[model samples]
Structures are given as structure tokens and as C-alpha cells.
Target: MTMRSRLTTNRLFLSPFTLDDVDELHAILADPRTNTIGSGPFTAIAQTEKWIRNRMAAERDHGLRWYAVRQKATDVLIGNCGLFRGRADAEIGYLIHRPWQGRGFASEAVAAVLDECRSAGIGPVWAIIRPHNTFSIRIAERAGLRLARIESDERGPLHYFVTSRANT
Candidate 1:
């Protein structure tokens, strides 16, 4: 029963994540292809749940929001998108299931999340994509997040992108 002013697109909805979404998320984690593009333990559902749960518990935004994506027609869970409190900025990230990839779903989900960030009064929402993750870069472009920086993470330095009100 969580609610927010941000509205994901009508064809699909990006609403706050709940514990109830465990099963859908489990499937996403269990698939190697999805994890490879999105990054995770492809064959382990429990591990995925733990990872998401820990993210849910993050006080980064003083516990602001995380969204689980669902289709409008069938309520089929597709993926997730969220705004996290980074060291000096707010960032958005998303992952689409293998079945949903290359279908323009990720782009749509990001649009929904950026709209959410706007409603939340966050400026210049950022995203960090692995160099090879072109799908994410496409979504970021659709959402108006431009390439801002290219720095490394624990995994490696990445192309850090940003979407701001000016760009939108």
C-alpha cells in the first residue's frame, strides 16, 4: 500500500518494491543471461533476495524509495529501478529481465523513474553503467541522462551518466 507522487508510464508501472515481489525477483536472479547484462548471481534466488533486501534497508536516502516494475495488462513483474544516495548526488539504476530486454522496456522504466525523481525534487539523477552495458546507456539517453564521468567502482571504473531537469 505504499504511495508516491511519481507516476511510471501507463503501459507499465514502476511502483515501490515490496516483500511480496520475492518470487518475480527470484526468477530474474536465477537467469544467467539477465544477470550477465544486469550483473548478479544468475542461478541463485536466495542471494538475489538478500541483495535486494539489503538495498531496501539502505538508509542512503534516509530510506526514500525503490521500485519494482510490473506490467499494466498482466501485472507481470519485469524489473526494478531506484534512486540511491550517492556520495555527492542521487543516482538511478535499473535491471530488466531477459525476456523483457531489447523490447524498449528498460527505457520506459527509466523514464518512469526519472519522472519520480523530478517529483521528489531531486536534480541531476545519475547512473553508472559498465562500459559494455549498451542497453543501460540507451535507457539513460532516453531519460536525458548524459555522460558525466567515467570512474571506477569496486568492479571497475564506469561511465557515470547524469539526467537533470535541464536535460529533460
Candidate 2:
């Protein structure tokens, strides 16, 4: 297994996306609720598979890996969390399955991703969220990121949060 597949937290394990995980990822991302904060819901399995392939390529080429977060006890894939090559800088992103929400899984997974970013010497990780996504904003804050600014776009307003420079 690759190093990207070995990240672990107290109750979770995080691994890089693989083609074999397409079905689980599709199940997680297919929900309209999951995408309401950012991209729209994925309607096809091909889109999820392509996304997984892109994540692998990002890790191979850009050193950015979106990890699949799983429960350590049952070893079930629960969601994905990690940094992606964003338009400006490395963006810290995460998604937990609908069934996994409200159980602190998102925060734990995000905390792990932030730890990985800091360990990798990547400073000032960014997290973009919709202004109304208060839950995610709280998760980002708890993960050691501070609100940087809010910007408006065609779609709507977005809240941009960044890790404190002291973390560098």
C-alpha cells in the first residue's frame, strides 16, 4: 500500500482513492444533500469513477491526494477527505456519507487532513464553503482554520477559510 493509504485517526482510517472504491464513493457523492454546499449531485457512476481517477492522478502528479475515510472498527469506507489542487492553493476538502453525518466523523476526518497538510509542509491550507454551510464552517474552524474572507460569484457567496500562518 502507498503512504497515502495509511492515514489514521482515533476512530477512522484514511486512504487514497482507488478505482475499486468507485461504488462506495458514488454512493456517498450521489446524494443531493452532499453536493448542496458545493458541486451539484453526481448523477452517474462514471462521474464518480472519473473523479476517483482524477484524485489518483492528482496525487501521482501534484502530490495532492483526496483520501477515502473509513471506520477503523468495521473497515467500511465512510467518505473522503483531503487536499486537492485548487485554483489558488491546496484546498482542504472532505465529505462523509449521509449515514455518517452528525457523529463527529467529518471533524475527525478533517482534522486528519489538516494534520497531513501541516506535516507535508504545505502551509495555509484553504477551505471554501458556502456562507450558509455553518456546519462545515464550524468543522473548518475546529480544524484550525480561520475565516479569511467572503467573496461573491455567479453561483453565490463563498466563505474562504485559511489555516493560520503560524502553522507553517
Candidate 3:
């Protein structure tokens, strides 16, 4: 789907990231809690800008993009969620700001994005989560993705959760 298309739920609106979103998105990315399982929080605003630029390019060149997740009421960006080209299939990923976690915002955003993927005929979405990331594992399971297998890379064990698909 095009970047103009937005995915919505009762509490969130998922829209494409724009250059203007750098400030707010950087706030979330700068928080250590949001990057516990990944490369770690961004240390500078330039990194956040580069990230937005790269995501925009991915949308333009590869039809893969991350949507900025915002609270519908206040229009504040709280996180991001989207489908990305994965090793085996399209993968879903999301990050909710620390203040917004535990309130079901991540789960809602993930469900909305998964619905969008399914509507676009994308199947067998995967959530390759670090084994120790119980928060994301629970979110994946809540979004109807089940643990398919566990694999290891240089980062260590990863739990590969896949959507319900016959081939998987």
C-alpha cells in the first residue's frame, strides 16, 4: 500500500513517517527503554533523521515502510509499527514509548498493522524477536502470531513467530 494510506484503531493512527516527524520520533528512539533489544537508543538527532530518510526511501523503492504510531486524541507520536522485508517473509515490528507501554498501545498498533498487511494480501508475516524480549513475544502472540521456531544468530537466540499459514 502507499504511504498515504493510514491504519487506525480505537486509540491509534499509524501513518507514514515524514521529515517533520524527526523530533517526536527521535524522542521515542532516544529513550533506552524502547531499544532494549536492538542496537540501543539513538545518541543523536542526526541518526533519527537518517532513519526517517531511510524508511522513506524504503517506501519509495521497496514498498516497505514504518508508520509513526500516534495517539488519536492528542495526535502525539508514541511509537512506530510496520511491515519490513524479512529473510523468509514480511516481518512486523513495533516500538511503543516507555510511558505508553503496558497500556496495550503496542498490541493495538501491531494488530492494526497486521490487518493492513493481510488486506494487502501479504501473508505469513513473521516477528523475529529476541528470546529475552518477553514484552514483544507477548505482543506477537496477542496479535495471533504463534511461536514457529527458535533460531540463533550472532546476537543469540531469536524466537520466530509466524502468522497462521499452511506452509509455515
Candidate 4:
């Protein structure tokens, strides 16, 4: 079995992704409505499997990657959230299933991951949200990230929010 920290909050538990979670992961990623501006609602199960495999590899190599978030009472997988090594720092990201959106789950997951980052001695994580993704912007802010700037990419403008430790 894969070894990882199991993080808990009042309402949810966070565990690292494993191959066993592909089905749940696929269910969450299959809805196109969940695919916001710059990411995916995976086109196929195989694609989702590839994503899980990649995350597994990231855990093996870097000891950090997205996690599976589930409801504490039912253990039903509801989302994934975490950080990855970015060009300049750790980049935070998350996704909650369509049914779970707007319930504060994403913010809870993000806050847990931020605590993990602090414990791991990682600093200055950043969240890149597409402009108009107000829900995500709110989650990031509530999780203690502050907007630093907006930058345009091939996909258009993205709002960059960094941890309180990062300078504006």
C-alpha cells in the first residue's frame, strides 16, 4: 500500500491518490462543467488513468502531489487538491465534483494542503485561477492566499494568488 499522511478536518478527510482511486477520480473529472477555464474535464477514462499514474509518479519522485478528498461520514470521494513543483514555487490546485461545489469543500482541502506545505517546509505556494472564476478566487482568498497579479497566457488572463508568505 502507498504510504501517505491522512489529513482530516471536521467534515472531510484527505488521502493521497492511489491507483485504486481511478474510478472515483474519473467520476469527478468526467463532468465538463467541472472543467473550468484552463484545465480539463478528462475526455476519457484512459486519460484519467494517465492522470492518476502521473500523480503516483509524482509522489514517488517528489513526495508531493494531489490528494483524494472524501466526506468523513460516508468516505465518498468528492474532490482532489494539493500542490506541485512549479516553475518558481509550489503551485496549488484543486477540483470538487459538480455535486459538491459551493459547499466549502475546496477551501477546506486547500487549507489542509497549505498546512501540509508548512510542515514540509515548502514556501510561497501559488494558485492560478482564470479570470471570472470567482468561486475559485473566493476559495483561495479564504484559504489565506492573496492576489498578486494577473497575467495573460495562451488561454487568456489568469489571476495569480500566492500564499501570505509571498510578496505582492
Q: Quick one: best TM-score, which candidate?
A: 2
Off by over 4 Å in 2: 1-4
Q: On residues 11-117, what C-alpha lDDT tens digit does candidate 4 reach at each position?
A: 99998888889888888788888865446678788988888888777777776767899999999999899766654467888989888898899989988888878
Which residue pairs collide, candidate 4? none
Candidate 4: segments with Cα more than 4 A from true spot: 1-4, 37-39, 166-168
The best-first sequence of candidates by TM-score reads 2, 3, 4, 1
TM-score to native of every candidate shown: 0.83, 0.93, 0.92, 0.90
What TM-score does candidate 4 get on C-alpha atoms?
0.90
- The residue-by-residue lDDT of candidate 2 on 26-116, one tens digit each, is 8888988766655678999999989888888878877887888999999988888887777446888888877888999999998887777
10 residues in a row with least lDDT, candidate 4: 1-10
lDDT of 1 by residue, 1-168 (tens): 122634558678777665677778888767777777435555666776776676676524254466788878888988877766664466787888888888888888877777766665666778878888887788887878888778876787688888765743
Kindly indicate the candidate among 3 and 4 with the higher lDDT. 3
TM-score winner between candidates 3 and 4? 3
User: Model 4, 4: alpha-carbon shift in Å?
Assistant: 5.4
Separate clash counts for every candidate: 3, 0, 0, 0
- In candidate 1, stretches whose alpha carbon ends up further than 4 angstroms from where it belongs are 1-6, 37-39, 59-61, 86-88, 165-168
Candidate with more favorable, higher TM-score: 2 or 4: 2
